[model samples]
Target: MNSLLIALVRALRSHCWLRLLGCAFILSSLGNGLTQVMVFGQLLRWNASPGTLTFAYMLATLPGFIGSVWGERLCRKMSPLRILILTEVFGMVALVFPLYGLLSHHIPALLVIQSAEALFSGMSYPALTLLFKRGLSAEELPAATAMETLIFSAQVLLGTGAGVLLFNVVSPLCILLLDALSFAASAILLLTTRKKFRVRDAQTMAADFPAHLPLHWKHYSPLQKRSILLLPALAAVGSPAMALLPALVQQIRPEETTGLALPLLFARSLGQLFGPLLLSADKLRQFSTSNRRILLCLVLFLGGYFLLSPLSAWPAVSLALIFSAHLASNVVFALGTFGVLQNFTSRQVATASALAWRGQVMVAGLATGAAGLLAESIGATGALYSISLASLTGVVILLWRYRT
Candidate 1:
C-alpha cells in the first residue's frame, strides 16, 4: 500500500505540466458540473426534442474540429494558451444562453450557443492535451493517465451531486451564470500556469505543406488524411446510439420517457468509473502494450454491441450492457489513440489528432441523423441491428489488421 502511494506521488511530482493541467481540469470540472445538471437539464425543460438533443450532442463535436484545424495554425503563430484565453472570453458571453431561450424560446439560438461552446472546446483541447503529453515521462504515462482519469471521475461525481442539488432550486440561468464565472476563473488560472508550457518541437510552431507532397494532400500525413477521409463513418457512432434512448423510451414505455431514461446516463457514468482502474492496472502493463490491449477493447465493444442490440428486447438489461459497451469502447479508444498519437511524428500529432477528432464529430452527426431516418423507415430495432453488424465488422477488420 505504501509502495503504491509512493508511486502515485512520484508520478504527480515528476510531471510539471501535469500539475498545471490538473489545476485546469479541476476548474473545468467545477464548471462542467454547472453545465450538465443545470444548463443541459434546463434545455430539456425548454422543449428540446429528442432529435434536437441529438443535434446538440452532434454540435459538441463540431467546434472542436473547427478549432483544431484553425487552432493548429494559431498555435504556430502564438501561444496556444493565448488562443485558449480568447476562447475563454468568448465562452463567458455564453452566460446569456438561458436568456436566449427564456425570452424568445429560440431553440436554434440555444443550439448556436452550444455550438459556440463546442468551438471553444475545439480550440482548447489540442492545446491542453499537450500538457498531458509533456507532463509525464514515457514510463509513467499510464500513471499520469490514471491520475487524470481519477480527476475526471471525481469531477463527474461531484458535479452530478452538485448539479442535482442546484437544479432543483435555481433556474438554469443561475447555473449558467455560475458556469460562466467558473470558466472565466479557470482561464485565469491556466494563464497563470502558462510558464509550465514550452514549445516541444518544430511541429508545435505550425503545420506547413511539404514541397514534395501531392497537391491534394499537402498539409497532412497519409494515415491522417485517410482518417479524415473516413470522417462520415466515424461520427455516426455516437449520434445513433445517443439519440436512440429517447425513442427507445418512447417505444418501450410512453409515460415514463423522462424517468427511465435517467438510467442510461447513470449506468454509463457508473461503468466509466471503472475504466481508469482497468487501464491503470499493473496487470495490463504486463499483458501487452503494443496493440493487443486495444484490439481486445474493440473486440469487447463488438460483443457488447451485439449483447445490447435492440433485438434483445430486454430493456433494462440491454441498457446496462450497452452502457458497458460504451465505457469499454471509450477506454480502448483513449488508450489506442493516445498510444498512436504519442508515436506520431512530432510535427503531425496535433494536426492528425485534430483530423481524427473532426472525423469523430462528422460521423456522430451523420450517425444520429441516419439513425433518425432509419428509425422513421424501419424502426429503432432495425437501426440498432445495422449498427451492431457494422461494429462487429469493424472488429473483424481490426483483428485482421492486427494479424497481418
Candidate 2:
C-alpha cells in the first residue's frame, strides 16, 4: 500500500500537467456526486414513478451512443485538451436548463436537458482517455489510471455525503448551481495545461499505431480473450440491481425513502474508492493475474446481492452489503480496465475506450428500463433477486467454461 501511494505521488509530482488535470477531475467528480443525489431526489419529490425514472435514465444514457460516434472522430482530429475544454463549457451551459427547471418546476424540460448533457459527456470521456494515453509513458499508465479512479471515486464518496446533508437543509437550485460551477472550474483548470498538449496530425497518429497491434481480439491468449469478452457482461449484470436501489428504498423503507437512498449510494461509492486499493497490495497482486481475484470478487458480489435481497429493509445491514457488493464489482472492473490500458497502443486506446464506454451506457440504460418493468410486475425485492440470480448463474457458467 505504501509502495503504491509512493508511486502515485511520484507520478503526480513529476507531471505538473497531470496534477492539474487530476485537480480538475476532482472538481468534476464532486459535482457529479451531488448531481446524482439531487436529480433522483428531485424526481422522487416530483412524484416520478419507477417507469419515469427508467425512461429518464435510458434517455440520458442512450444519447451517449451518438456522442461517442462523434467523439471517436473528434479525438483523432483535435487535441484532447481542446476537446475537454469544449465539453466542460458545453456542460456548464447544459446545466442551465436543469437550473431553470428547478426554478420553474418544469419536469419535462429538466429531463430533456439532462439527456442532452450526455452527448457532451460521451465526447469528452474518449478525449480524456486519449489525453492520458498520449501524455504518460507506458510504465506510468497502471498507477496513473489507478490514481485517477481512486480520486474520482473518493470525490464521489464525499460528494454524495455532502449532497445528502445539503439536500436536507437547502434548496435543489443551490445544488444545481454548485454543479454548474464545478464544470466551469474544471474547464479553467484544463486551460492551464495547453502548453503540454498539441494536436497530432494523421501521419503522427498512424506512426504511433502499429499495424500489427496486440490489442486485436485474435491476438490475445485464451485466458485474456475470455477476460476481455466477459468484462462487459460482468459490468452489465450489476446495473439493473443498482437501478432498483431508489425504488427498493421506497418499497422496503417507505418511512425513510430519500433519506436512506443517499447513504446507500454513499456506501456504493465508498466501495468503488477502496476496492482498487485492496488489489494494489503486494500480496493481492499475485492473485490479479491468475483470474482467482476476479472470480473471488465475483463471488463476493453475488453473495452480497443474495443477502441484500432479503435484508434491504434494514438500513444498516443493507448499507454494509451494498458496499461489499459494489467493492467487489469495482475490483473486477478495475483489474480488467488496467490490463487494457496497460497493453493497448496509443491509437487503439481512444477507440477501445469509446466502445467500452458506449457499451456500458447502452447496457445500463436497457437494464434500468428492464428493471423498472420487472419491479412493476413483481416487487422490488423480487426484481432484485431475479436479476442477481440470473447474473450469478451466467457468471458461473462463464467461469466454468474458462476453467476448462
- Highest TM-score scorer: 2
Leading candidate by lDDT: 2
- TM-scores of the models, in the given order? 0.77, 0.88
Q: Tens-digit lDDT track for model 1 on 273-385?
A: 56545554344333224345554655555556545544445667866775676566556444534443344444454455565556666666666666666766676656756
Model 2, span 1-404: residue lDDT tens = 54445556777888888888888878876776677677778988887777676566666666877787788778767777888788778877777777777888887767876577678777876777777777777766666657656655855586787898898789888888888889889889889876654443233566655556434556655555443434455656777777777777777777778878788889988888777655553433344355566667777876776676478767789889989988888877666566556546677777776766677677667666777788888977787777766765766666666552
lDDT of 2: 0.71
Worst 10 residues of 1 by lDDT: 226-235
Model 2 clash pairs are none
Model 2 TM-score is 0.88
